[model samples]
Target: MAPRILLCGDVMGCLNQLFKRVSSVNKSAGPFDALFCVGQFFPESSDQLDEFMDYIEGRAQVPLPTYFIGDYGFGAPKVLLTASKEPANCGFKMDGLKVCENLYWLKGSGKFSLLGLSIAYLSGRQSSDVQQYGVYSQDDVDALRAVAEEPGIVDLFLTNEWPSGVTNRANASDVPAGLSDSMGSDSTVAELVGEIRPRYHISGTKGIYYAREPYSNIEAVHVTRFIGLASVGNKDKQKFIHAISPTPASTMSSTEIATKTTNTTLSPYTFVEKGSSPKDTTKRSSDSVSDSQYWRYDVSQKRQRHGAGDGDKLCFKFLSSGSCPRGQKCNFRHDFDAREQYIRGVCFDFLNKGKCERGPDCSFKHSLQHEGENYADRRPRSENSSSKRSKECWFCLSSPNVELHLITSIGENYYCALAKGPVVEDHVLLIPVEHLPNTLSPSAEHEVELSKFQNSLRMYYKSQGKQVIFFEWVSKRSSHANLQVVPIPSSKAALVEKIFSLAAEKLGFKFVAKKFDSDSDGRKFLRAQFDGNSSLFYVELPGSTILLHQIEDNEKFPSQFGREVVSGLLNIADKADWRNCKYSKVEETKMVEDFKSRFQEFDPNC
Candidate 1:
């Protein structure tokens, strides 16, 4: 059974009125698990400050596990700062402090789960200027957008500002006329609601109670219900409290999803079930099939150890359009990230810190890369391959712009970076410290060192029950070449082989398997084939099988074909473009730190 929750509008430091109202509600509706208050938790006038402090300081008692977000008023900063200092209040999600027992503050912006329900919040009064007390910061929006990216559900979204156009868009005549006009809906908050697509959206500061009908969202499975409340001590005696028990729609069953997604056209950016694949894959007679097609895998014959991966999957229609007919019966990933790794905008991390955290995982281009300086020259590198190459090569390990913190480990010849937009946590790039065009023709010593590095990685991932796949696209214009290393569940390794072959086949090129006596021999063979003009597609399979495809100068080959294969195999095909997986620098820093900790023991250079 779902827990009962009581939600209220601004309290305005009227503890006496609040107590009386709660007592009345308790008698009438009685028991509720939690009470959430929004907008102006502090007093408007000096007379009410002492009474509010009394309740916050614990001189008086808080009735329940009361959480609130009215971040401004007479004594807000003073109380919040004090609570921030308390050790118990510092939460993992960066959620705010506890003022007194059972009383808490939801500061800044973040989300957390309560009673099996997900809740996201943005705290601050609406303002145009960058005021400390009011107005949302870019960081807040960035963090919220990041939250919106995670896979799954956000049951409730709480904000201090009403979403702009809520009244007009909702046309909720039930709300008092022009009440939301003076305040209007906050554009940022409104946009957030549209992106988050939560089951329930609650806001306050308009000083009126409004419960709009569930509205449609094209990219989400469940409809959203918007509620606005008036001040607690309003002279009009408008409702200050509202109560409801909503079963978190995130827990819906598959039967519900099947029902809701009838005729649902999923978003182009999301997963397209293989059965519904838009790409036509007509098999030719095996006798006439190219050597590449020989690797074709039968996905039907494979058994997925886990049923379709994460069970918290969202409804297809909900993810595609933010609204589903299933209500709470559907299942799929409602979290924006779950929809696809490739998002249709700039990197969220770059927007926040001018740097992207995901490296290769991020599908979006780093806006900083477009700065006047040649991005290739700006990467970190060692001494004088040319002051020019190091300066122009963005991938050079010695470049000033290099996010050194992203380096996972140091090797004798080559080093690794967590891809700026990594497809997975351990996805890394193996690059030579000295600038070079491609891995096709490394000297024997470098080959041995690179081999050792690969061996070490192979052994480590094997212990973890995973397989690491290596691929590279050496551009003629590339300042340096780095081997793209990705890890996939061993179960998927067979699938990876078949997909790459299919991808190459679709592009009218065949990946010809070439066996070499050793790594050095393979490098020499590839170097002769590079011809200083033709582009190369290369892959290293799990059992030391190597496939190479050459796209001569005259051919039009999809440069993204390699990444497409990898992303498709991982079910994140949207992120093949790199522009799709943009994430925050803070998160990237975390990714680096995590990699460092995991790879430290195996690191040969460091």
Candidate 2:
């Protein structure tokens, strides 16, 4: 047997009138297998709307699905017509077709299918003006027909506008002028039905009218004044009156038949079988109807494991739009769809940060939620290398003036360092304890820790008596790593140079020196220099350590070693290279002696 579906037009202010009418007409009317409301209107007050929707659903008693088709605000439909895997708050079942601006479909029983298409308002402009109506277009009609063409599946079309084709024009004024007269002329409701060939067509535009019989295999019905204060009555009688009246109609007969009949055949179960159950009947009834299933709120105990200290509460927030501070250029543009995609891709590249395709997978719900914090801690991890490690400086070990501060412990294999040069009072060198090839790409945890440490260093320098000058250098040959050096005032530069020179002498190594000044091209080597009175020198060290004396002369050295060293150092300083090392350590030492010999001859003051 085909399923029986009840299709109704916009409820507007006629809900009360219709409800009373239905109660009086069918005292024993069987529950509808499916109840579809083309567009339901509620009062401006959210409370009233909530109450009305709740009462309607509760009274229906069946899991009968209700849908809306129209535009609410926000220029888009606000109802969930289909299911989603990871649904957002906006996606939920039974939220009541809030502000729908599209077509909807619901299949009931075994035979009947209810299809609702919202007719876009005609503004008397071009036909394409329907786009502003926030409703379906001609293409949508074609799509509906394709779906409804299935055999044995009865289709019912309901809309606010009187579709193209239909002889009745009772309440033409009820419909907008552009739609009323022109719709029938261009494409009547009957023609549209012929196109889709639905089993039923219920429209509400023209004056009060009804078709006495069914047309073709499909039923074409019209109801003018179907909803009004006068229509509220008993099984046999109905009156035509305004919907705002509170009093019942006194003159209305109790036995007059309100439903007109024609050639269309009613399904055997139309007056018997009830509709299907709702997907979330229990949840919806127990919880607030406005409560979204996709949204959850809970408080849980949290404990820090490695990155942060123990028992520290990590508060995270997710903002949809306009959450972050927009400086001169607003980063939060509606057109950031591409940027969002890029962030998601980069986040997926690393697996540790919650496995999100977006930045900071943030899948888990944290107590504290905020926007722009997830991407706060982003850093690349270093890959392993096979180069030999350099020996520790003996002078640094023996000097009592040196201070070592452990900024952060980045995971099991790596640590960050803040080393104070012995002779240099406020001079500090920031280095990673990890023997990795590049610090540019640190582990996820390290990335976060690095940022935090940098912030702390900035604060520390500002608090001290001397200003801080920061610099970083890298080597080209060995997988280049950065060496961060911050020079502080109070004779720190001279002191650092003295310690470095003394360390080389004690270690039986020769000092390979290069002078960089503001005028020299080497000045470009500075990474981030502060404007304090103190001078700072930041040097990037090569991943592969070399003997200082071996770098002085161009002699027999490691394979392509001289070019590699010069290139690496120049790269770190962001400058052009002018000096090269010798091919051999012995010859390089000789060259260093000769260079120093010429310097001494030029300056007798020494």
Candidate 3:
């Protein structure tokens, strides 16, 4: 039997009411392991302090082994200070410290095992000011990240504030009654949840109970269920406590651990670019998506046309778009800074406060290599060597322009989504989460996740009585990689190789066929076929046969070669051009939801 635990929401210093309800629940659901609380553990006013003090001072007994966060109410500082002075509460404790009999305070952020369940927690809401008793700091977040990197899955994660955008794909009816999707939600908490990938993320402080449908996590083999409890005692009588008896992940088999419910949705914490308008993201016109594909080439051409002068700098508008309205008449330079482009813009937090709380984790540029000598000296030289995607790139997950509604699944290094202006139904693209030019050769860990996605998709399509073909065109223009996965009727599976070869012959090129048992071996063969910098295209068929082609310099290859061949094999040549297959945003959203629902069973991360 698993450990039975009771989880509760905000107590708000109502010790008597909370205890009364706990005692009642304990009588009915007798012999539970422990009780955990989140949000406003202390009272807001001094009048209620006496009741809170009674429990802490042992005048009134706590009913069960109760632990709590949200240590920031009226009497929190004095009580915590007194506890810290005790010998048992001394140094760097991750687990709770006993303040009184049956009562414990979980301070800061840490992870510990109790009753065979691995639990991780962040004790307070995010704060910008220096860390004190009630607020959590950057150190706490970093500390948890280190713990999250350790071995097995975390069974439960406790936090005070709700993660930002927690209701992104949730139904309006399923959301809490009075709470908005993003109100009072902290982005830092969201990031931590994404990284930690806990099985159950319990939070409070919103005063409305919401038991969200289980959500899939990026790069993890398990799903996370978020439950936000309401206040302990409220007029609406909303549920403030929940009971669960979960078997620890360590004891469960791999198959049992990966089980997912039918309603599992994609992770809600999609990287959203700040300050982007709704219109920018929802524009799914074929022309816009196509133009955005070669944005790097466009930037390069603009730089060539308007050379950077001694007194001029790059035009931000021109750099973002291929063309600026001013054209040749602009006063500023039209060239962009190649080094600064990848980091997006300067870090506003660093600029305003001489220091960024995110530090190395920030996605924005801190300072120019030649500018800010003091800051430059402090930064590691290798920090700038690593590449990151700009928000302007259409495929980058952090970009404001990304079509969030189309995304189905996200992993650590890659994500899967329906293609914009898809060639056919169930047309999916497996894209690198980072900004990368090609997928000819990926790292070992990346290859493992990529293979899992491929196998999952293969099984999914197989169940539909169809065969899947994967293809990618490594462009010389250095654009983002999108490995196209298309499904064809089983009857037409034999014709796939024939059609691709015919298309290649028509384009005055021939493919070299290679056999490999696994994706890793195929990648090794590809790396040996051509240098990493060369442009190439490849197709992986059902029988482990890969058709590889290395495009020579200035080779005239059609951009739609793979889609055209697959379209012909599926007898949908008219839909070969993605523009012809465009769907309305409403229809696209329905398509994504449908794919997510059907694919949940085969989702490896689920």
Cα lDDT tens digits for candidate 2, 1-606: 333344444444344555554444334553434444433233334444543444434442223444434232221222222311213323222223222222222211012212221111111111454434334443233223323332121234544444432432321223323333343122422333443443344444333333323433322122122221111122334233221111111111212212334433321111111121312112122122211110111122111224322112111111211111122222112212111222232221121232333222122232211233232242332241122112111112222321222222232433333232111222233344454333334565654454444444444544554433333323222222334434354334334444444434533454454554321223322322322222222322211111223321111112222222222222321111111111354543444344234323222123
Write down the TM-score of every candidate.
0.50, 0.27, 0.49
lDDT of 1: 0.65
Worst 10 residues of 3 by lDDT: 288-297
> Compared with the true structure, what per-residue lDDT tens digits does model 1 show for residues 339-392?
221133444344323465446433345553225433222334346426544644
Per-candidate Cα RMSD to the true structure, in Å, reads 16.0, 31.3, 17.4
Q: How much is the lDDT of residue 440 in candidate 2?
A: 38
TM-score of 1: 0.50
Model number with the top lDDT: 3
List residue ranges in candidate 3 displaced over 4 A. Answer: 169-173, 271-606
Residue 485 alpha-carbon offset, candidate 3, angstroms? 38
